[model samples]
Target: DQLSKQQSEGDSVIKKLKEELAGEKQRTHQLEDDKMNIIKELTVQKEKLTHSEQALSDLQLTKQKLEDKVEDLVDQLSKSEKNNFDIQKENHELREHIRQNEEELSTVRSELTQSQTQGSSRNVKDDLLKERETQVQNLKQNLSEVEQLNEHLEQVAFDLRTENEELLEAYEEVRNQLEESVAGNKQISLEKTAMLEWEKAPLETELCRAEKRVLEEERKYEQTVQELSSACSPDTSALQLEQERLIQLNQEKDFEIAELKKSIEQMDTDHKRTKETLSSSLEEQKQLTQLINEKEICIVKLKEKSSELQKELDKCAQTLRKNETLRQTIEEKDRSLGSMKEENNHLQEELERLREQQSRVVPAPEPRTLDSTTELESELSQLHRIKGHLEEEIKHHQKMIEDQNQSKLQLLQSLQEQKKELDEFKYQHEQMSISHTRLFLEKDEEIKNL
Candidate 1:
């Protein structure tokens, strides 16, 4: 008996050890599976790290390119600033020259006015000279007339003396008339001489004033001419120097522009490389995320497996307890079987009756219930009709959407055509504007010639 018990105990221990070994083996398999998953995840991470490193390299290159571009831009800016300073200086000089020219122009205008005044004075002097010569000729003609009148008077007096023997009274009257006429002629000559002298004096004074004005104007004109000559003189050397400077500045600007263009090209290349790198990095990140998700799923499965293993262990323990209870019942079965048979038959009958009662208690399908069924059928028909209506409405909506899409497509096509037309119109307008400008220039030239 002792040996049997010992053997049984040893068997139990062996069974427990077997169960433990099985559990441990399952645990080891689970661990191996987890390890494989971890390895896969680590491999994915390594690939991602490699991708990131490549991306980082690309970013560093891009950063370097950007720094170079910034430096080039800064250099260009400095050059531009210098060019601006030079241009400002040139503008200042041009303004100063313009101011000087304006001052000179005002002086020239004053001289022109003075010259006009001098010409008027010279004309006045010439008129005075002509007037003086005409006055002298008139005086000579009057003297000759006086001489002829005197001769005629002497002849008449001699004739009257001979006739006085016959008519002394008539002769005396004629002699008195002749004497009065001679006196009147002398008075007129004296008045004419006095008037000529008075006119000559004022004319001489005016001539002197006009001559003085003419001399002053001549001097002013000479000064103006000298000033104009000086002002009109071109600073050819300075202009040439400025032109050369401008050319130099243009060359510098071109060089700067070239540098900027190179920098921009480099920047574009860097940006493209960076974009490629970023895309690769994103793909790697996506892969890493997928791996992480897979790992999470594996972990969940492992946990479920562990729980299932625990449940199996618990079921085995429950089955062992049930076996122990069944063994005890088997030992008691011989004493109770005969009495249990009668009770079992009675219980069977009761169980059947209970089953029948349960069946009766349950609701049964009835033909009169067909009224609710018909109502439900009507509701179903209504729902079907509603569904059909909705389907028809959906079809109508689909047709409307299709029509809208077609209209939108047509509108887009029209817009494209309109854009093309606009481009053509713009080109035509540009051409017209150019032609107009040319025509205007030609017209201007013609007007200048006319």
Candidate 2:
């Protein structure tokens, strides 16, 4: 009976050992599978880390390039500033030169006036003519200078207008880009936020499931702990292995959570950068607005100057017309003065013949009455007074004619300048038309070829 009892205990112990061995084997197999899965996941994570590192390197390179370009632009801006300074210095020198030219013009005008006054008294007609020609040449030079200054002013206005247009176009482009970037960034942010939120929702659900699984695993672990406490010493190692496996799983979960948190932090940084960029764009927009306003003011000033120039041009035209009319009147006066001189010459000859006749005649023995002698003396005084008046009138007419001739020469010079300007305008128009025609023809030919 004791041997049977011993055999029964042996059988029970052996069965218990077998069951523990089987449970240990099952646990070891499960651990092996878990290890393989962890290894695969680690490899995947490593690959992802490598790709992220490469992308970061590329982004860093791009940032470096952008910084370099910004430096180049700054250097270019400095160079442009120096060029502007040079241009300003040149403009100041040009203004000084113009002032000198004006002084020279004034001096020439005074010399011309003196020469005109002395023309009649000058014995050498040839010298007077040469002097007059020189004066005319000087006046022509002054006119050319004035015209050149006018052209320069016009060119400056054109350049300003073109620059204003270019600035407007650039401002518009920047504004459009800013608006589009804002819209695009907002859209991208919304989409990314939505995507992240959607992903987070799934992750939360999965996390809840993982927590429930963990709870179930904890229950299993507690059951194993209780079983180990109640079981033989041989079962303790299997229970310990199960506990270690659970710990490893928990550590993996924690690593995944940490990765998600890092992604969330990166998203936050991106959102902040977007906000900063938007603020910078707003500042740039404000600057562009101010620039546009300044350009508008400049354009307004240019228009006012153009109007003033037009008024001056009109006044000049009116003066020219007045000069032409005065020239005609002076010519008529010259003809009248010539007629008066001829009449005076005839009267002088008649008076000389009467004097000779009076000398040849015997003394008036018939003795003229005092009344007859008095009448003859009165007529002679009246004729002398008429002759003096005619001489004064002739002198006045000649002076007026001289003045008119000078004015006519000035008007002629102005007319020549106007004609030259007109021709230049016509030539420019023709060039523009020809270029337009060529472009159109090229387009037509291309269309035909197509």
Candidate 3:
């Protein structure tokens, strides 16, 4: 709209200037000739201005597209952030499971300690046996629940890994799209610039040709005026009449010359304005080219980052495999612990049965032999040793559980750190994109304003 207004005002000024010229019979003939030439020159200048305007509009459109592309990238980054958040939540849940398992392990350790302390009491053997059997059953149930939860957690982890992979692929696609758009914009601008330059060259050449023709005609008219003056003599009324007409014609030529000078001055001004516009447009083109170059570099960086992320994904996948293997080892250890508890239960039953037998039997001469008593005593001693060995195994398993828990904690921490780093990189990418867009927009507006 603004461009049209400027064009309309230029037209109105040209009309007013045209109207100001004399319409005398002596003047109209040559004035029309000059006016026609000036109109052609004006049309040529208008064409240049139109080309500049078209270029400006094209740049504005490119700016709008870049902004839209940046906005889309921002949206994708946000989605990636959301996915990371979900993964963090999943990690937190896994941590919770670790904590619960740790607590259960501690409870089991304390119960085992209490049972060991009470082992010397013979009267409570039956109670001890019953308690051990019950505890073993509870332990088995807990292990089963833990194994189920671990399977669920593994599935969740797998799902998260797949999601991360999908997001990474999506980001790569977006990056490629952005790169292609930048390339397209660069190509389009180059082509338009070439076309405008090609088009302007021909128009300028034609304008120069017209100006030269007009100059040649003006020179011919001057020569004819001089010849007509020389033809006129003071002796006859016809000659005097012819002389006066020539004088009027000369005066009209003077007027036309003055208008020509003014029009030439206007042309010079318009030419300068056109040059400035072209120079500014060139500067904008340079900036756009630089922006495209920067975008290409950024795309390269994005590709590298994607490659790094893929590596990280592979590492995570590898870690998950290790975790699965470790989980199997831990489950196997739990099973061993369950079997040990069962063996301890059996041993406690035997000890209780021996205690009951001892409490009921009398040391009669024929029924109880000395060797049998010694054998029972030796068996009792063996059971005690086995109990001690089972306790040692339980302690070793507990230590292993503690170590596994620590490893898990470390793994979780490392994952969190990696996530933070990933977030930081994404944020930096967003910031750079925004800054680049803003700078390009500022420069674009500056060029157009110029």
Cand. 2 Cα-lDDT: 0.44
Stretches of candidate 3 off by over 4 Å are 1-122, 233-362, 365-450
**Per-residue lDDT of 1-450 in model 2, one digit per residue for the tens?**
644453355446445544644654464465456536534643543344344335434433543443354344335434434443443454455446544544554454445346434432122223433443453354345334434533443443344344434434543443354344334434433443454345445445544554464455446545544554455455557545744754564465456446645644554554455445444444544554564455456445545544554454444445445444544554464455456445544544544454455557746621432333344335434433543453354344334434433433343343344335334433543443344344334323322321
The residue pairs that clash in candidate 1, if any, are none
lDDT of every predicted structure (CA atoms)? 0.40, 0.44, 0.49
Per-residue lDDT of 265 in model 1: 51
The TM-score of candidate 2 is 0.34
Instruction: Give candidate 3's whole-model lDDT.
Output: 0.49
List where candidate 1 sits over 4 angstroms from the true fold. Answer: 102-450
Model 1 TM-score, all chains together:
0.23
- Compared with the true structure, what per-residue lDDT tens digits does model 1 show for residues 193-229? 3543453354345434534543453354345334433
Weakest ten-residue segment in model 3 by summed lDDT = 17-26
Tens-place lDDT per residue, model 3, 298-354, is 556655654554455455445455545654655575576557656655655665655
